[model samples]
Target: MVKSVAAPQAKGKSAEDKIFGANNRAVALSEKLGADKVINGTVGSMLDEDGNLIMLDVVQKAYKALTPKEIVAYAPIQGYPDYLEAAIDQCFGESRPEGYIRACATSGGSGVLHHVIHNYSEWGDEVLTSDWHWGAYGSMCNDNGRKLREFELLTPDGHFNMESFKANVSDMVAKQYNTVIIMNSPANNPTGYGLSDSEWDEVLAFLKDVVKGKDKNIIFVSDVAYLDYSGEKHECRKFFKKFGNMPDNVLIVVAYTCSKGFTMYGQRMGAMICVTPNKDIADEFVAINQYTSRATWSNSNSAAMKVMANICKDPAKVAELDAERAKYFHLIQERADLFMKEADECGLKYLRYISGFFITIPMEGSQKVCDELEKENIFLVPLGKGIRLAVCSVSKKKIHGLAAKIKSTLDAVGAKQ
Candidate 1:
């Protein structure tokens, strides 16, 4: 009788998430087997060598200095002006494009997806992204009553598949009034691949060709959640300059987040930045997305915004924060270098990895492989085509020969063909 009272869409909906399910199992196993013995690679959150969550000292210092009003008072629905400015500066740096820019406070990069999916695209429209992507894109689209369409992420020769990208975007724009394309680059999660500047040229050129004279709207979402870890700071962001002076119909949305960038995951602070040559479109983006935010979470954390502004406003604070993040970035790089070297030596195959929190190894029966790995107290999250290992969460010493161990495990499971 109670089930009969639920709406059609809400019926049969449960709260179980696959990634979280795997993470929970990892937690239980780690407690029983001891943390040092287990390789916990279930999630993207950065962890120290001792299996503790990482928090930047400078970020902590900045946040702890906030006043009570900063903690409790309601912030503007669009976000505080100073935080908006900081988000812009932090995201684009010196290579900021020549366009009108503004940000709407979002819960995280996930919130950016929610706002764009709800505000830009119509109902029943399928959002487009690459095949290898963060799993939440699909979750967010499904929850919004929309769907996700993916094109091949890489070509047979290991390059960005521009042909597939163009074909998919062109077809989708033909069907829908607005086509939203989300590209996770500059340390893409789970795969760690970032497009080169030439690839960016191809992407922008293709987009310009797609909507040359058409009235169709193209919302290009560049999700740079892992940008800070990708490569050299300024070089990685040079692509942002390419967004300037694009056609009025094309709007660039940067899904900027403090969760990864500033190590403030729990605070859930970030911004949905819109860049466009047309000033009116930028204004509309702020208005509509803020309306969506007001109707959803109402407002963001004020203390986090204040801390972000404080860090950005002070030159010394900026350098301290940068150096703090840089230390962890190098730590993760060392872990990855060791693992990649060992994986190569052992002849184990994985996706192309740049520098990021995760790397994926291809294997059949993902769930089964993950289950078998648990017997060794080694936890990894299963994906559609492989298993994702979060190098950012595992230490260099533990990662020394993880690849060989996994290879041995695959052979034992009769999956190493």
Candidate 2:
């Protein structure tokens, strides 16, 4: 007889996520064969032409310069104060909305996401996001015993599906007391897609309308994990200003991560920043999320927090970090440009790519085509939406005309639509 074990939430729990599986295969193949012989686009983090993981000069210097005490000591449960403020400023830039704002330290963006879903959404209730999204969102929801509701990510005109979003949001609001929505942009994972300023306005307008005369709560989150690599200074954060003057029932949360921004993937430093027109909401946010922090993970990294705070607060250091990052930023841009140009030439249609680590090419038989591509030493992760090509991690040498190869493979396998 099976012994009584594991909670109900833990029963029938299993996920053989193909993304990580494919990534493992890619890394194994790269090791078995030579790295130069393979186009490994499976990993989401940045890598250079020599197949080296990117490390920001400022992060290395600032972190190493920390005292042994800073490295070894315990931090405040919510996060060191400086790190919390820096994380907020890093997310909003000069365009921070005029509203009450607060932040708490987290293990990483994923930690913040977990807290958001757990605290804001009812247990066993439904949450929402776009059809084309980072896979981890689904995992986080599933782990928390919440259902994921997805809407079309794009319209026929290749813009944000505002109508579909409104329809889904309204449907959920009618049924659920709290509707939590995740919107990742300025380099959405698995799809290099970013909504324009006007598109953002449309989304806000719809959300504002949904809150009108309704008792439901709106928890809108901006998953800004890759904000730094998304675009130019101030440009990537222009959407934040729109969050000001929002209704009291609406709460905007931005999940900020040091992993992608500072190239400190293992440090596991992140924060959750909340924005609201009401002071009560802001105070309640700090109270509730801070308690959640204590219950789970406790606090984030002290040394890493100090490092980021030092980098952000110092003018000279900030400039140095910016200059160092600009070099790789442009390198990523060049890679994306080459791949997109080739895709256009090869007649391969992909999702609208404003700027991001991924570009999803829409086609059927994603798994079949991806497996076939592996034989030719070319690797990418396939999603239900499409095949995700990580432009940020691939080199220019391999990116040039790579789309043509993918198209050719699709044709050979009769996977082309």
Q: Name the best candidate (by lDDT).
A: 1
In model 1, the number of clashes is 0
Quote the lDDT for 186 in model 1: 81
lDDT (Cα atoms) of all candidates against the true structure: 0.89, 0.87
lDDT of 2 by residue, 1-417 (tens): 666587887877778887778878888888988899899887888998888898988888998899998898899888888888888888898999989989988888998899999899988999999999888899899998898889988886678888899999999989998899999987887677888999999888888888888898899999988888878878888999998988988899999899988998888989999999999999998899989988987877889899999899998998887787777778888888888899999898887887778888888988888989999988899888579998888999998878999999888888865
Evaluated at residue 87, the lDDT of candidate 2 is 84
What TM-score fits each model? 0.97, 0.97
Off by over 4 Å in 2: 1-5
What is the TM-score (0 to 1) of candidate 1? 0.97
Which stretch of 10 consecutive residues in model 2 shows the poorest summed lDDT? 1-10
User: How would you encode candidate 1's per-residue C-alpha lDDT over 279-308 as one tens digit per residue?
Assistant: 899999999999999999999999999999
Q: Once all C-alphas are superposed, what RMSD does model 2 give against the true structure?
A: 1.6
Which ranges of candidate 1 are over 4 A from the true structure? 1-4
